[model samples]
Target chain A: MIRFDRASKRYPNGREALSGATFEIREGEMVFLTGRSGAGKSTVLKLIALLERPTRGLVMVNGCNTAALASRRIPAFRRQLGVVFQDHRLLTERSIFDNVALPLHAAHAPLKDIDKRVRAALDQVGLLDRAQALPLELSVGEQQRVGIARAVVVKPKLLIADEPTGNLDPALSMEVMGLFRRFNEVGVTVVIATHDIDLVKASGLREIIVADGKVQDPATEKLVVPSMEAER
Target chain B: MSGWLLRHVQSALFAAGRLARAPVSTAFTVLVIAIALTLPTALALGIHSVRSSTGEFANAVDVSVYFKRDVPIEKARQLAASLRQRSGIARVEFIAADEALKQFREQSGFGAALDVLEGNPLPHALDVRPKTDAADPAHMESLRRYIAAWPEVELVQIDSDWVKRLNAILDLLRRLVLGASALLGVGVLAVVGNTIRLEIYSRRAEIEVTKLVGGSNAFVRRPFLYTGLLYGVAGALLAALLAWTALQLLDAPVARLAQSYGSSFRLLAPGWRELGILLGVGALLGVLGAWLAAARHLARIEPRS
Candidate 1:
């Protein structure tokens, strides 16, 4: 569950990454944030993840105001949701299992529970056999899956990803998209930001188009329509 | 509680593993800390040994009251007896002129020369030892004046100036030791802090990732704190070992030197209390340094993407 009320972000270098961008996503929905490069999709995700606060207006994720949340409380707030980056963000020196078990460790989960959950998350991503392999030793897709496994290891209710399929082949990209679809099928709300219009069209998910640091009006925007409108 | 302890143990082991992976750098860092600690610890122990060896000399201050050569041995004995009744005088022993000459002849190896001389030239004297509490310079001076005013006394000499000078030198050395310990303690802190800073810098990527994945500042800092603590603890242990070895190497030579002085003084090894302090200080400084470095740098490394 995420809601943005005219959220604006201006970086320290005076770059306005987002301006009055407002949107809402209901629970249990998988949505794609479609935007060109530097079109503010990542900014939206950053705001949602509390990596950067909004310069103006309001952004809420899982009932906590991202702009007003205390910095000390940010870690606990982040544990309620998962974030996957385009670069995988895995510790290269550690094994795939260690990388995936990070979130559980961060949460101070029991060692036994951490081992079991890590294995389970890796199994879901089809990388159970590569548990002990380092991130650099794995294929790029497998590395990204390991990142996904890490993100989901804590069983966060909302999962947000930024350009996760950016470096993958179209086939691999679709496969990664299918993994997201599987998680969504089990009632995990997912938000993915991407510029892959083809992938967005093929996935047939609800699309939020952002341009020029603003969210486009869905009614008149020239993009893929929401196919699950009747359910909404 | 067990889970909490397990996490701490895990962090400690992880920190140790990281240091082990970079053995050369870690060893160099620890050596610097040990050297810094060793100087102060050795100096402190040396001061302790010096103080203990000179304990008797520090407490005793004696004066000699020599009577005029014309004074009779009977008058000298009466004067010594009266001096013993004084408030500040601890003991008084009358030495007859003949006895003094005999002692001088035996100790100075002047027997053949003295055999050719006429009658004994030494005067009767009283060896006066003052009470420990009245051995201060002013008190000794006043006591000497009191004895010099005696009609039959020719000289009243307080043989305590050298003792006072020795105590002054010891006091100066004690201050120097205190100053050096404080400065070297700061040096230890700086060494550990800088090492931890570099460690944090090298692991910046891991820190960012951990923080990104819901890791608290405390969680991210746990390993670095443990790393600092290990460095401090290991350094202290090595310093103790080094100090022990140095004492062993110097013990025989020191004993021989003391023997030359007709003293049985031996160098004292560091005791359990000193060892405990070294370890405790090392661990405390290590934790403090790591905490400082982490507090300064960790919060600035937010995940950008």
Candidate 2:
């Protein structure tokens, strides 16, 4: 679950990535953050991930205020959620199994449990046979699947992905989207940020459109600015 | 607890594997640390050997009490007996004027000149040796004053100045060794710290990925710490070996030099205690250097995307 009440983010370089962006997504919902490049979708996901706190206003994910969360608690907070990046972010020197086992290792899980779960996650991504292969040795889609397996290996309640299919063919992109859909079907809340409007339309998921540092209502095609006076 | 230990073992093995993969660089780093550590270790051992060998000479300080020419040999013997009775005096030997003259005649080659001059011109004397514990400068000075106050005593010479100078030199050398050890210890830390920093820089991608997947700073730093620890331990062990080998090579020469001086002093090998200290220090420096590098660099590498 996520709630952003007029959250604003201004980076150190003075670029206002997000300005007064307000949105809400309930538990067990799969939502697409549709926006152009540099349109602040990634900034929203960053706030949710606690990678950067909001410059102003409040951003809450899973009942924890991203702005108020202590820096020491950020790791534990992140462990409860999954994040997938467009680049896959796999350690190239490690095998696919080791890459997927990163999250479990971070958690200090039992070695037996880690082995079992890593295998299961790799199997889910249809890459069980490539467990011993390095990331560079795999195809781009297989690498992305390894990233996905790493994300879900810990069984996080919430999953957020940024441009998950940015480098994939349309067919590979559809397959990746289907993998996310399968996870959502099992009640995992998913938030994906992408400029793939076609995929959003085809997936028939709820879409929150962001442009020019503001979130716009897809229904009305107008900016959905929060009423500040009502909150006061 | 077992799981925690397993993680540590895993990190240690992983760190060792990384080092093994880069044999040339690791060996070079270890050599630098070993050389730095070896200087202080060898110096310390040298000081220990020197101190132990010179211990008897330092304690052999003797006071010579010469009696007046008119003093009778019986009276001088009685005085020597009384001096020996004192608690601080270990032994006292009374030499009659006749015996002193005979020894001087035989060794100084002045028997014909002395016989032409007078009969038994040398005075009676007592050689007084003090207990080792009471042989300090202050104690010896007091004993000299006490002996000089006697009515029949003409002179009381301590013969301890050379001993004082030798002790002072040894003390200075010990302090120098301590200072050198400290400075070189810092050098070791710097070498290890820089090495770890480079390793961290090269593994920047791995670090970012680990942190991106919810790894804590401690988790990300574990491997680097292990690497530093290995470097330190390996360097220390090699330093000990180097110091031992150096001692072995110098042993024959040193013994020959001592023999030339009519002494049989041999160089003492580094004892177990010294080896333990070297190893412990090496391990501590390694861990500390790694910790410093990780603390400075790991926190700055946040996942950007």
Candidate 2 — which pairs collide? Answer: none
Write candidate 1's Cα lDDT for A82-189 as tens digits: 899999999999999999989899999988899999999999999999999999999999999998999988998899999999999999999999999999989899
RMSD of each: 3.7, 4.6
Against the hidden true structure, what lDDT does model 2 obtain?
A: 0.90
- Candidate 2 C-alpha lDDT tens digits along A1-232: 8998899999999999999987888899999987778888889899998889999999999999888888888889999999999998999899999999999999989998999999999999999999999999999999999999999999999999999999999999999999999999999999999887789889989888777788865543454534331111
lDDT of 1: 0.89
Q: DockQ: which candidate is best?
A: 1
Query: Residue-pair clashes per candidate, as listed?
Result: 0, 0
Candidate 2, residue A129: how far the Cα is off, in Å: 1.7
Interface RMSD of 1: 0.7
Q: Positional deviation of B275 in candidate 2, in angstroms?
A: 0.7
Q: Indicate the TM-score of model 1.
A: 0.91
